[model samples]
Target: MNPRDTEEMTATMKRELLCVLLLCGAVFTLPGQEIHRRFRRGARSSRVTCRDEKTQMIYRQHESWLRPMLRSNRVEYCWCNSGRSQCHSVPVKNARATCYKDLGVTYRGTWSTAESGAECINWNSSLLARKSYNGRRPDASKLGLGNHNYCRNPDKDSKPWCYVFKAGKYVPEFCSTPVCSQEKNGDCYFGKGLAYRGTHSLTVSGTSCLQWNSMVLIGKINTAWKTNAQTLGLGKHNYCRNPDGDAKPWCHVLKDRKLTWEYCDIPQCSTCGLRQYKRPQFRIKGGLFSDITSHPWQAAIFVQNRRSPGERFLCGGILISSCWVLSAAHCFLERYPPHHLKVVLGRTYRVEPGVEEQKFEVEKYIVHKEFDEDTYNNDIALLQLKSDSPQCVQETGSVRTVCLPEADLQLPDWTECGAFWLRQARGVYNAPSLSFLTASPFYSERLKEAHVRLYPSNRCTSQYLLNKTVTSNMLCAGDTRSGGNQANLHDACQVNMSVSPYSEPTPG
Candidate 1:
């Protein structure tokens, strides 16, 4: 077919954009246009049987306007539940916080494995095929739970826990999320951290910290964070702390879960520069969309709403460590309380449950003290995940931390790096009736990476960068190919729905 045919087809398909108030428990997509039409017809019959006059009226009012356009071969479709009870209209808000810390309540990130290495049982699973349940289960959406078996803390437990099928019973098991008694800020270590008493018990590689006092230790749990135990800062817990005067904080954590103790991967506080600085990569230049296998350090962040039900996707982050995520300062401009954020790692798909996904509650929030929202300088923020035991997140094949680029490290110009991007909108503005379809959040449902390159510093000067001021801290990088040479990068700048760590080119 010629380009004219494609143009005509696209124009005809988007002739009318209509918003049908389709209500449903979860977003469900159709296999193809043929299936969508078939299912849409079946949904029409629900107008009366479904007993939802209001929704039927709203759909029917636009049906006449949408009939001709819906018949187009190029259109896609997805049917929603006819019941009003199942429908949840998410209030659209400008995303700010890089993460959210809830009461272990509406957790949506996919972290399904239990602390005991047991896989969580799905909420909608038929394992309890019998009529009565041992305990009442809350609505899956209440905790941002899909039908999948991802772990969540519904009862406001000390940490996120899920039920595992044991023998004939569903036994509850806690995930790696920090418990209230043992949770603490895992980010900073000041002046040897002698007085820091929070329990953060894991090594950088997810190893449990060894107790200074071997006698009173029960498991990796510290009995007292006291100096009287005569070891180092052996206290009630084996959390990471600096009892001995060292350059940075260190602890004797069990290496590889063995009896032998080895100390490594302990976070060193950045005494000089800030750890929140984020390198901007607008779009992947040559590569379009890659997956977690390629960019294991990529992280997705979300914020919980107090007045609303489901969590909202806020921004993308780079996992610098197991317990810390780095994003842009603008992502947290609204000044969301530290507890309103949670980070998800190892999730290949935005909403789909990943088998090895891990979720963490934010324990500390740090934005650049000198951030300039106007100039976009210092556009960085750091989120500290609450420590549960020792490590906040377990490293997985799809969820490993990225190494910090060395200051003295040398690389050639145009050095390519991984990037996260949102799909740009096509100029297919149909009639105002279908505005919802044009702005639907369902597009780009999976995690993707784009290839972007590091240009020579001399070439990225103010004269070459659209006359924007080249701040000392700012880095200029984006796709420069013919079709992708648009100056702006990162979808958060355009879309009001989903946000990502980004800043305007430092204004001249």
Candidate 2:
């Protein structure tokens, strides 16, 4: 009973082992079939033409595997190099087929069918034919052909060539005119898309157009001429128009690669009208006599006396321009007529006349419009002189014009300035008839100048003027030194004479 059971069990185990081996073999064969299917599909999709005998024989070995995948009913094969046929066979690709139909007649049989199979039939024979013809003819006959014509056939052959009749030669085709054309009028044309159209002149180069932003200066042109503002394509707000005739010529500026007319005059220095003469380096402190040339712009103003017919010295002035004199407006307290006033320049002595002294009559007097009599605010006045020539006092070593301070000029507090004037003093003398009689003050008779420092506005307020309105325009000057008796005080008591009866008088 044990032997029979062992034999049956061995047979069943053999059968089970054989079934497992067969299942493993089937699993491996499925992948091989899938691989074969993929290879056949690829071969059928690509139209590979094999012209060489060796290549044809190799392809035949693979045909059987690929034939089942082919869907086309009719198929012809030819050797193709870069999509063009290498043999005498026609191209099957749609693009190459069309190209053969258009230009094949020109280069037919010119190429070998199968010498080395390296050169193929160029289906685009029209391009090859045009290139061949172009090399044989003069460049003038092909001027109309664009640069791209080298790779493709031009649409038409009879297009006009860019030939110059006078030069008897052809030029290359251009997108626009290379040179500017002068019109019947003064305007000119400098190619298309350039804002320089209608310009008087233009500059350019062979390879490129003129830079549209380049600037051209036409000097000293009358600004009255109508400007070509619109043609330049500049906005109106970008420039200023000078209607005043005294303004300088305008300049044309290039903006945004376009010409823009604008005001080009450089701002003149405020010191331009100032005399260039160097000031005397040797300066003196305290009250001292000044040379006539040292203060050439100094002036002595005289007014006709109402009681006496003779003129009387009134005040001092400064010559600021060729025909204008600046002085304290309060000097005209009597409201004297302009004809009654006279200006004496280059005078060193108060009474005696100087050699370089020039006299001038006043044509007009203009006190500051905002002058205040009580506070002496805006005490300046301009006197226009009456003269035969345009200039009143000829500029000389002793009669040059002085520079007027700018309106915004500021000097630090305590800045020393020379104050020129004539000083007078009186000495009491004992007499028999009177207890003490005072003689008329002895006039200095010479131009004396004193160094005075400017006082800060805060220190020169209404409080110092006894509650008087000390306006902003009013300026205060005083001696900067303290606690010292002024030996030769000049005009120190001019404002304090009311407080002290014995104060010295100052006349300027």
Per-candidate clashes come to 27, 2
Cα deviation at 59, candidate 1, in Å, is: 99
Best by lDDT: 1
Candidate 1: list runs displaced more than 4 Å.
1-287, 421-443, 481-508
| Candidate 2 TM-score versus the reference | 0.37
CA lDDT scores, all candidates in order: 0.51, 0.43
Please, what is the TM-score per model? Answer: 0.38, 0.37
lDDT tens readout by residue for model 1, 1-508: 9999999988766653222223221234434555666566645543422223333433321111111123343321111244322233332222221112555555555556676667777665566434222122334344444356765666787667777877777877776443222223545543445544445666556677766665634454433434233223444456666655555445665444555543335443333212232233343322334456445666778898779898877777767666777766777889988788888887767788678788888887788777776655666677887775545665556676666654455556545444443222111000000010112344456654334554466755667645655566555454544334444443212211112233222111
User: What lDDT score is found at residue 32 in candidate 1?
Assistant: 55
lDDT of 2 by residue, 276-353 (tens): 233333433334555567667777888888887798777777676767876666677678898999999877777788
What is every candidate's alpha-carbon RMSD to the true fold?
33.9, 30.1
